[model samples]
Target: MPVRVVDSSAPSQVSGANPSHTSPPACTLLSVGQAFSGTQNVSSLQKDEAWRVNVRIQGCDLDHGYLCGTMEALNVPMADTPWVIQVVTFWEGEIVDMKNYTFFTGKWEATVGKPFPLMVVLSIVNRSEVDTRHWTKFPSFSPLLSQVEVDGGRSLDLSNYPYIFMRWKEQYFVNVGTDCGLTIAGFYYVCFSCSDGSINGFYYDPNSSPFQKLELKITNEGRSGFSFSSYELQ
Candidate 1:
């Protein structure tokens, strides 16, 4: 699916100070949301509802910037072959004021089974300042089957059970199982801070808006394995 951007501007509000000779704002290196694109197809095993996400960058000095995020659904039908669903980085738009900068946002969906789970990742970089800090939060996925492994010399039941793995920031990894699942389905608030080597700071505000809520569901798609049925964030 394509990338979507959300507008997060409120009544004129100010929070931080701007330094002399300010550099351009940071660029969004990556962003991934499970609730982007409304609803997406993952092979033919199962279908899942979409989640909602909103991202805002406040307290910075820059007029224009770039950002991108991607989400992938993995299905491992066999030890040697696997299926993947992915969304990558794309430009959202330009920023005019740091006090009221809300640029990136969207929703997405997917389908999966036992051998795989949903994975999301996001990354941002500030080019204007040597040091920077930003706050971000999105919905987390809970896997139906938590852990599995494949050995070359061992005989395994490949048809009855599948394996899944999710990686974020290329450092953290999560295993999906039958017990774990996403806990929420709404927007989260974050704070960002940046400065040259002489000055730097960061802040993150928890989501307090009344419109934030979570909804989740699981379905049996009648395939050889289980599948995600529906999900909504409103």
Candidate 2:
């Protein structure tokens, strides 16, 4: 999987900001959607440049049946540059929700020490089938550990470190369990399990390096221990 960029000249539109609202007016099935702004390619720029991404979310209105918002991205200087950022909403070190705005930096900015920008417009409508009951169909997996074992038998303590998210596909990543539990660090190593082989999601911490290529799978044994392997980006 590869990192994706949101064009900044225009607004990126995503749907379903808060799906758990139970009010009749705010009742809508949540689905992940994205729209890119009209930003240009920053791959040819020098290391002294980067993009500035801004975000704002209008609180969900129970009376109105609508959720709307906007995000902005601008190319700026690297000296005081706002590098790649992950806007995460959490409480007391436990992550509630997270989103990544890479703005297409993986294509060229990955090695440039600078990242691009993205602007997003979030407009969620009451379109999906209305279900009063909150959906809990996905199985849960926990990856909030201070230490994890890589393929080399070495242990890595990721407490207080930037999160390393594994890309599962274009604009999507393997889910790192959140809201189910709380941890001392805001971030943890990427690890999880799924018997049905159905769960995949996204996570990003701006402090970490640009997105990298990785290979992830479940062994045929099904009950094997958790392990992670990192590959050199080509």
Candidate 3:
């Protein structure tokens, strides 16, 4: 048989979980030279909902040196905006490539980073803005981080500030929020503005139990002043 549907009970090689859901995930393994041309309903963990995405694998074969196929995403959870489906190709438990699709219902050309005969795991991840567990770490320091100076007024070490997991610039981790030093805060950046070469914004004060305001200003010369003010939630 050119193709066989691997059981969902097979041992998992992938790591990481949604954290909010405890239900075991369902997966399918499609090997190179597979003759599959039908659809399979794969359950996905999105917003703690049992969302099913009908995936169709067609004409799967080797193209030039990479695995190529026509993959379609159907019957996805309906939304006001299109859902972003992430296609992840894993080779021997290591991710080789990834792609995204803004899909309500659509088909896309699937290509694996490696060539044929080498079986890979094709995973369909439904990305949601509310799911922070799957959020990726930043490759570098946030742009806002560079403009601010910390206590003792020393410049922040970019090396210690990498990999702050974030979904958007609006919400992120800050390595240094106070004199406490090297503390990770779940605070977020709000109301960022740059006018006449000056920048200002508010960050949740990690030093405070409730919402406190941390004021920062960046001048044209790249010098910034930091101050703290208290406020109560309405």
Per-residue accuracy of model 3 over 1-234 as CA lDDT, tens digit each: 001111111112212211222211111122222222222222223222222211111211211111222222233332344543322111111111111101001101112232111133222122221111111112122352222211110222222221211110111112212221112222222221212111121222224222222222321222121111221111
Q: What value of lDDT does candidate 1 attain over all alpha carbons?
A: 0.20
lDDT of each: 0.20, 0.21, 0.20
Give the number of colliding residue pairs in candidate 1.
32
**lDDT, candidate 1, residue 6?**
26
Off by over 4 Å in 2: 1-46, 60-68, 75-143, 146-234
Look at candidate 3 and tell me the lDDT of residue 101.
Answer: 9
What are the TM-scores, per candidate, against the unseen true structure?
A: 0.18, 0.19, 0.18
Give the clash count for each candidate.
32, 11, 0
lDDT of 1 by residue, 184-204 (tens): 222222112222111111111
Deviation of model 3 at 196, angstroms: 3.5
Q: Between candidates 2 and 3, which one is better according to lDDT?
A: 2
Better of 2 and 3 by TM-score: 2
